[model samples]
Target chain A: MTKMTIPLGPQHPALKEPVNFSLVLEGEQITGSTVNLGYNHRGIEKAAESRTYLQDIYLLERVCGICSHSHTTCYLTCVEEIAKAEVPERAKAIRTIVAELERIHSHLLWLGIAGYEMGFETLFMYSWRDREQVLDCLELVSGNRVHYAMNTIGGVRRDITPEQKTEILRRVSILEERTKYYIKLGTEEATVLARTQNVGLLPHDVAMNLGTIGPTGRASGIKCDVRKHEPYLLYGKLDFKEITHDTNDVFGRLVVRVLELVESYKIIRQVLNYLPDGPIAVKVPAKIGPGEATNRYEAPRGEDIHYVKANGTDKPERVKVRAPTMANYVAVPYMLNSGYLADAPMTIAAIDPCMSCTDRAMVYDTKKNKVRIYGWDDLRKLGIEHYKKRGVDFSKL
Target chain B: MSEFEKEEKLKAQLEDKFGGAISDMIIQRKDRVWFEIKAEQLVELMNFMKTGMGFNRVSTITGVDEGEKLGAFYHLTDENGIVTVRAKTPRTDPHLPTITGVFPGAEPYERELADMFGIKIDGLKPGRRYPLPDDFPTDQYPLRKDWKVGDAYPEEKTSPATEAK
Candidate 1:
């Protein structure tokens, strides 16, 4: 019996984000594992204090590319409550539409990444290719794909036009069909089931104690979806079920996410149909009086919290953000326990860990705007090319 | 019982139970209650909330840097609603009891708070820095009001004391 320790990421092909895990292995079995992450820290919370309530909305929106609306909405909800402002009915509907669309795109992206990690290249391509449709719908609705910037203090920034609503429904219905096929593959595919079934187990009780939320919590049978439990915005009016799977394993999580894709599609349709007619936003005064509020929303990953204390200044007195990854961090070691080292990447991906959301950055090349869709393979090629242009052979190095 | 009444009743019960440690109890809003507790009694209140009062899940542990004092809020969630237990300590030496014993989920939030706000917890396992660079300076807590963003840079002396020196 030999003891060994291996480190995964800050930089690794297996993980998309910057997170380091030191694994202590006895043979193929992982005896102990600890995760270390800080590589993505942008000091956004600290930065928020220096910005006005208006600027903080955009700053907080960039917290996670996948769950941008969740951040802004949580911030807006808190600030709005503090000011005692009522969000217009139309604004709430639009917010819910964007949020559900973000969920759809996020889950599809996670599915592709999960497939890529599993060495199933075809599944990766199929999921991301479908993910583009959701991104397009988002762009059509909010004018930007990643940072929606649609949440204002009193209401939302944008309204859903008739043409936009028609286009969104058409695209989302197509997505629903594609999602059904993925659901079949996710549940019945031998490779996926073999790799995921009963692997990386975090039982229902453990999940509750660790306070895991969203799909991960539901997969473990801990019913803690903030939307279902709290029902903020138009989520109360929307007709959709919170998907739950009691397997408490990687397979269950995969099932839960795929099911959520279908559910999010339904929610988008519901919000679009019930898209109330009213002003999208109202002018909020600069100074919000002394008040405090805790706003929680169900992000694509899990529950996201934004606590705002306004002391009558334009800037929030104190704003604290608790992203889902922070809440789910404690249960990672428990999931990694007794798990195989080979299955490690899939196990980590099952949690759909978002290091950027927890710690945080991204770089956009304006030159490559034509190709809105790209995959890990394309990214790897781009990296090689990016270095090769500097007269360095990346492969040789 | 109505949701609002259940929350008020819960607040009354808590105030009655630990009247000595509590200073003020503010019903912040519907389904939300904020209590100002002594820094020394945060853990005791957290334990009582989780065990006795059935506030089983730890929602969040937020750290706020007030100029002269540091405020920490512990948000606990249950069927009733959310109860936020707050405690403040001096900014010079912010130290309080840790509630990881009651809510294991709060460990990460507490760690981040400890690192970001220069706060000290009496007990939280391992006590290593999280979501921060390993080589990050010990004296400079990023979230503090007085800490500038580029303070670590060579020529970033903004404070008047630095100019005076």
Candidate 2:
């Protein structure tokens, strides 16, 4: 029997990022996998060198959309470390609230995508419909649903108004009830369990070896959450458990994410009750001082690390960002090549891959690789050849 | 332990490791340590801390493009607060001894630093490009100071999430 490799994508409808996975299959089961990235390397760190510390906040927020708040919070934490600036109590509370709310929205969004991948269109629509509640609550406080621009130098850019707080709590209560139902349906439904439960079993040692982080790492028994470990902001003060599972399977990942929604709600409630009173932000001084710092925070997915060096100037000398998804991608091949081709889309979707936000193709006029064909013609030819080999209609191709 | 006491203990441990490598170890405002070390003795100093001291957790490995040369930062930590070991290698051929064999977490960090800064690490697999695309042009490092960022680079402008949203 001859074996063939199937290229999943540099472009696939199921994937949000341009991660090309060459699935070497023996029949319908995946035998081996090679992962490809850099379809979304936006030179974000390098761009920070040219921008001011204040400007980098808005810029870095654009690095990953789903985790934009996390990115901004992570960057600000590192800079705050270097500047020795203290974020006021109210700022910390507000930041923590936003962080938790973002976590809730992001996990729901992932659950929705996973549902969509498994052909559960109703679940997908339901999750998104519920996600809008959090979005509306976020917009009510931070002005924008997506890029809230809620972070500043020494503190947060905005505060949660009293009226807004009531709305947030009311909406969160609704979400909590809805989330409980979704988790019950997702985990207990026989079809959903059959599709996911034991499909992608990333064992503990292998997960650590691949350097998987966030919920993926937690799913595999690795207690490596920045919140639980090195608590920055109000995470240390909050009263919530580090929800972890040792299964390291697709179901384990799902459970961790769903439970995190509950934990996030609890943290949000704590922030509201213990609301602090103070200014939201303070003016940071600009200078060329010889100081640098590294800060890590728990993003919705996993650990987000930021390294900031300032020469006392308003601009950073160098800024380095390490996203959780970048670390978790290392374990993808390990997870995908363990039987079940049909479930590949959902298993990959579980990682929530976020690439460059504005990835544009730059076609240089000079290149060497036979006679290059452009655009749809190339795709059409490949499709025709594929269908012809499979004895399918060329017109369908 | 308090963050200040954590810094103090780390400072004493560093001074004991290399005797004179501790140029300045101050507890910064965040209660994190800012430890400065001489460039030449960094790799040996880090090895000593790993083998001798109890600084087992390797938080991150990063680089700063300092025009003519690059400054390497090995952010190491434990239950005590963070301690950053600062070192510099020439920009022309920035190379460091690989710490992956000792500290397993450092492998990905080293690879990322190598790909981004073009810094070579001795003893690791010579050609391991994990994240950079295969067709990505040679002689160009994406995270470097002078990588071409004109309209010609495909990933020069945006991220997928921005377009998706």
Candidate 3:
């Protein structure tokens, strides 16, 4: 069979963000793949250098709409350490609450995208519908749904009021019930099982060599979570298990995420129950240090790392951000190889990729060559039709 | 053993293995450590850290502009924490050996180093520019201390109507 290459996206509906993937196909199977990024590179790292520590909190929060709190908290962890400020207990608990809620929101959003990619639009609709509960809970506490701006250099910006706590618990319990149903549905649904099982296999060794992190690595049985390995903030005190699955396929990723939703709820309950009473922030000098520090955070997607170097000024000398998506991207080509071309979108989505956070791009110009362009809708429809032929239709649902 | 002690033991082992080459060693905290070494020794140190010390993951690589010199920090990780290996090269002739053979994940980061700070990676496979537009000026390194926003692209042309006005 002759090899044909197709371009996936730089602007396609299949991707939540702008990223391009060039896949080389031999008949129905993908022989090779290359990911191109930089469509969303806003140079936030360079911008952070020009802003003061306090100002950079808001700047870094814009790194990812889904993991806003993760970036801020990670950046501030380095900033606060260099300044040597002690955050209060209540602030830590509040931050932990927001983080867990963000995790629930991000994971649920991924579940919806997974369902949509697999042509199970019903799961997409239901998970997104349930995701609003957590979004509302975040808005209630932090006054905004995304990019909460709840974190500051020393600690958090807001305290959790008792009334708000009660309401949050109420919502969390509701989400818990909904998530349990999802776990049952994800596990037992024949359509989901057929679409996901034995697809996009990432072996355990490949996952580690590529430095894959978060639930993606966990699904491959790497057993490396920043929260468990190097606990920060209230994670050390909170009780939750690091979920792992050794299946090392798209099904394992789906199972890990749905199960992680339950763990997020558990963490939310623990944080609210143990909410302490104290000031939410502390004062630090305008000039931070001639020192540097690196911080690692377990974002909803994976491990988010940040490095900050202060030059005895209000502004930082250097700021570096390593979004989780960037770490997991190296494994995309490896997983895409030897897999059916129809499974590419699901495999990419399984990483919960956030391109804006990674802010990288690539370009491939095959001008004088034969190539096919597949729009987002075309690829999605192709996936649905491909699965329908296998007797796993969700069209009626 | 405690995290702090574990880090200390690792530090001792590293010092024993590559004594004079490593310098400015500091235990930043319990779970983090920092040290500096020559840019030429990066590949050897990274190989030992990966195959010998079990620091199987390269968390991220950071490139910094320090006025007269260009510096890079390879944040290598294992279950314990991050052990940062810092190296510097002259800005006029900045070159660092790539550690992609030891940790394949470092490829993107090394490319990033080449693009942002103009620090050339000795053995990086030639590829398209990353996290930057293809038309981005070759001479302009955005993260360098002297780079300015206006340096990336040419000034926009004035319309004939505007010029007349």
Residue A202 in candidate 3, Cα distance off native in Å:
0.4
Interface RMSD of 1: 5.2
Model 1, position B27: C-alpha lDDT score: 76
lDDT of 2 at A160: 82
Native-to-model Cα distance after best TM-score fit, residue A259 in candidate 3, in Å: 0.9
Q: Which 10 residues in a row give candidate 1 chain A its minimum summed lDDT?
A: A355-364
In candidate 1, what are the lDDT values of residues A235-307, reduced to their tens digit? 7777888789999998899999999888888888878887777798888898896888997888999988889
The root-mean-square deviation over C-alpha atoms between each candidate and the true structure, in angstroms, is: 6.1, 9.9, 9.9
Provide the lDDT at A396 for model 1: 53
Best by lDDT: 3
**What is candidate 3's DockQ?**
0.43
Candidate 2, DockQ to 2 decimals? 0.23
The sequence of per-residue lDDT tens digits that candidate 2 reaches over residues A62-148 is 988878899999898878877778789899899899888889989998888878887888888999899989988888888777788
Candidate scoring better on DockQ of 1 and 2: 1
Using all chains and alpha carbons, the TM-scores for the candidates as numbered come to: 0.90, 0.82, 0.90
State the DockQ, from 0 to 1, for candidate 1. 0.42
Residue-level lDDT tens digits of model 1 in B1-165: 755786788878888898888877887777788888998778788888877988878888888877899988888886436788888999878898778888888887788888888898888788458878888888778888787756765455553331111
How well is each residue in A45-152 modelled by candidate 3, as lDDT tens digits?
Answer: 887887788888988899888899999999989998898899899888888899999999999999999999999999999998998898889888987778798997
- Where does candidate 1 stray beyond 4 Å? A355-397, B1-3, B156-165
For all candidates in order, the CA lDDT equals 0.83, 0.78, 0.88
Error of 1 at A363 (Å): 15
